[model samples]
Target: MAKPASIPGLNPEILAWARRRAGHDVATVAKRLRKSPEDVRAWEAGDASPTYVQLEKLAYEIYKRPLALFFFPEPPEEEDPEHRFRTLPAFELARLAPDTRLKIRDACAKQIALHELTGGRNPAERLVFRDLASTPDSDPAGVAEKLRDYLGVSVEEQRSWRSAAAALARWRESIEEHGVFVFKSSFKQQEISGFCLYGEEFPIIYLNNSVAKTRQIFTLFHELAHLLLRLDGITKRDDSYIGHLRGEEREVEVFCNAFAGAFLVPQGVVRELAGRGAPADDEIKTFATQLKVSREVILRRLLDRGVVSRQHYEQKAAEWTDDYFERRRKSGGGNYYNTQGVYLGKRFLALGFQQLYRGVISRAELADVLGVKATSLDGLEQRMLAGTG
Candidate 1:
């Protein structure tokens, strides 16, 4: 049998660079590529090379990098996750699951797509992140009220929505109307509820579609607050790290939590619902579901109002946080195209198709923008028109 031909002109430094960037060592790459460790070492040392097929697998499968990166003179400069999420501790950033990293990476690619699709300017008339900029130390309640007013969504209108799903759809549309592009994906790391990447013109929130709609709604606001503060953030199931943050970082995370709660269920409304005293567990659970408010937010509100003790709140919240997550996993299954629509989002899909129709982009480019196979575009558009996506 002939030995596979090695592809020449590929930079060995970039091969090593990509591997290190992806947090893998020589042995790991060798194992994944089914090659001896010495072979992997030789490839990175410029003494040997990988075949085109080997390079393709290494670029796409092992490192999750673009194929062209291997041909570059040197590795491109990308922001370190630690620096991007300034508030998160080094330990916290290190704990990010591999899938979580990929989702975040994909989210960045979507931002580039947005910039290219809209000619470097946001299509929205007003960009909320730029307009609503605030300090981490700013009054979260005031900021929440201002954001809610800017969104033009009121408590009465919020309650008027027939169901949580309807409210989510409306809130998502309203948010997109303001400039932030919201996208959804199934996060293999259930601990990650959602995250947001702040940008000048294309700030975005990426949510975990596997979570309950209530948690998703809360996460949207939590991440929105981060963007409003000109910061990138992650909302996780295990949020105990908030306590570990110090000074400005602590304030930022705390503000995100406060803003989401205040925006979703205002204090006055919660007080009114509680009436004479603290709400019962059932009432908290019921109202949380009906209004698409999170149980954690409700309990936190009660804790703030001197209704529930901090101890009670903490214990109860810890107990209930994982319930919906597991239930969501068990119940997950749906039509593929409809699911794709929901994941890519309506506004994004419409914009991509509009570009394709105008001849601004080709079918292959449209597929990358939508993150769908070119052949799958027809089925996705069908669902979008039927109002299911």
Candidate 2:
């Protein structure tokens, strides 16, 4: 029997570019493709070529790039991974997990889709990012207060939500209403709490849906703070990256965290709650529940007020994180369509579906842009109508 034929005259440079762009070295790609590293290098060096089947797997499976990308005369331009995340430490940026890298690519694609969907204009009456800018010297709480007032969701209104899940939903809508599109994905790397890509009109906050509801809410504001400052950022489970920064960069990192904490549990309220003395953990926990925020936020505020020692606050924060994860482990997975709808959110889904209904985009295009399979489109739309945030 004749062996499968290789594609003649394939551009080895493009194959090499795709692998590097995907953050995989030759050995990693070769291992995943079940090819010898020498053979893979030969293909990349133009001494050999991959068969159509091999190329297909390389395009869709290994590199997570389009098959057409390999045929381009030159690799397309994209935001530099390090440059896009200017606030991320060099150490963290250099060692970004492969899956996290892909998530960043996924985020860039969504930004491109938004441009195509909206005809290069934001639909919101006031685009928040376009209107807001911050300096390193900006007061974190002051900016957060301005943002909260602009969002128009009063603290009294926040307390009325009564549950973090409900608050997250409302906060997502409030942000979306102000023109910042929020997206969620179950990150392949759970240590990534959230990240945002800043654009003048279409700044996006992508949260890890696997995170707890309260933490997600905190992250929503944290990422928003980055957008307000007009910089892209990533939030991890540990913020040790902050320690790696210096000067204005360090200030910006500190500002983002302080901004989020202050935004979620405003200074005045926390101060009042803490009163004349150090509040007990039980009291802090009660305030957190009432505000639909994480205990860490309440504790951090107390620390800022000098009512709680740093050592005590850190110990409690660590314990709460462990408890949260244990509870999450016991909770298990949720319904797929519902999760997807919530991830994409109704604001984004409406844009795609409206475009499809108007014949502006084909069903396939809608599914492609939404990152849902065409066959699953109906189910996703149904969940969108059922109103998952």
Candidate 3:
């Protein structure tokens, strides 16, 4: 009989650290590794170790860390991502899905790559909108007008768009043109709408693609509010947490929400359609169609201006919310390459490929930066060049 394989010794602290940093519990790690929770606990407790083959999988696949890190005398200190970006409380942030955590880390790495590729130059130097700053106390309507001019997304231009999806694409492209990297992901959790990472060189805004296109449009502006405020943070549209906030926290949330509404459904346009009376369902739908915003957005704006009663607004908002999610559930995901283009913003991929083509980075390096296999680069390049992805 062959002798039993020897397990490699690893620092137990590093084992524990990697799991925690990945936001995984023992059970989760065990399930991914096809082991029992007790086995994972034993590894972390220094009572047992994974074999050489198992260690490689744990480091590369499970923990997504370097194998050398496991030999450290102590787990190296990792910067709390929550500190760099204003997010929920630490406990709440830790509860974020592992996939979300991984995506955040991947985005951070990609931002670093962009910064290096640009020779540490500030890409926002030429972006007029990056300098457009505002405070929570600023007038939402005024700020919205400035942003519209900066983005060149006038109501007239928006009216010419073929559909809401087209408007969304145009808006995203406009923002990316201004030097912000806008990407989308199908987050499993419904609570998280989007997040922004503030940077002088490559600020990033990530939108949840699983939601309705209209909601994603709203979130796009909401994150833009964060970028304008220079407030890097994660955003969730869940109404349950509203009552829990107070003072500045509450003010920031309210300001961003109001800014998104004003930006999408300009007050002037709202007044033009709404006049002095409560708007009917048909009127709300008409405004929503013309503005390319959700009916809930129009209703909320009317509610704020006393054009709609609170009771009526609440009923309409709830109904619209339910219908939106139901429709999203029934809709089929479209083309894969197109979805990939949305996932990895066109501008981002363009920059990565430019670097690759210029020999500034190797194909392997580009794959690492873009988070794809090196073999997949050729296909991705073909799709991107054809404007299919």
* TM-score of every prediction relative to native: 0.91, 0.94, 0.89
> How far off is model 2, as Cα RMSD?
2.0
Give the winner by TM-score. 2
lDDT of 2 by residue, 1-389 (tens): 96556676567899998888777888998898798999999899887788898999999998888887888888888876788887788888877767778888989999999999989888889878766678768999898888878888788999999689999999999889989999998877777898999887688999998888998998998888888888898888777678888887888888988999988888778768878588777888888998999998898888877888989988988899889889888886888888888888898898989899899999999999999899999998888777755
Where's the lowest-lDDT run of ten residues in candidate 2? 2-11
**TM-score of predicted model 3?**
0.89
Residue-level lDDT of model 1, residues 1-389, one tens digit each, is 98676676799999988887676778988999899999999999998899888899999898888899899987898775677888888888887776788888889999999999989989999888988899988888898899878989888888788777788888899999999999999988888898999998899999998777878899999999999988899998778888788898999998888888888988787777767587788888787866677787888887877888988988887788767656665774888998899899999988898899999999999998888789999998887788763
lDDT, residue 91, candidate 3: 54
| Clash totals for all candidate models | 0, 0, 0
Give the runs in model 1 whose Cα sits over 4 Å from its true position: 1-6, 25-28, 35-42, 273-278
Clashes of 2: 0
- Name model 2 segments beyond 4 Å from true: 1-6
lDDT of each: 0.86, 0.86, 0.79
Q: Give the per-residue lDDT of model 3 (tens digit) for 126-233.
A: 563366778889888789889888877788888787778888888898887777878888887776878888776677888888877788898988888877877776
Q: In model 2, what lDDT does residue 114 have?
A: 92
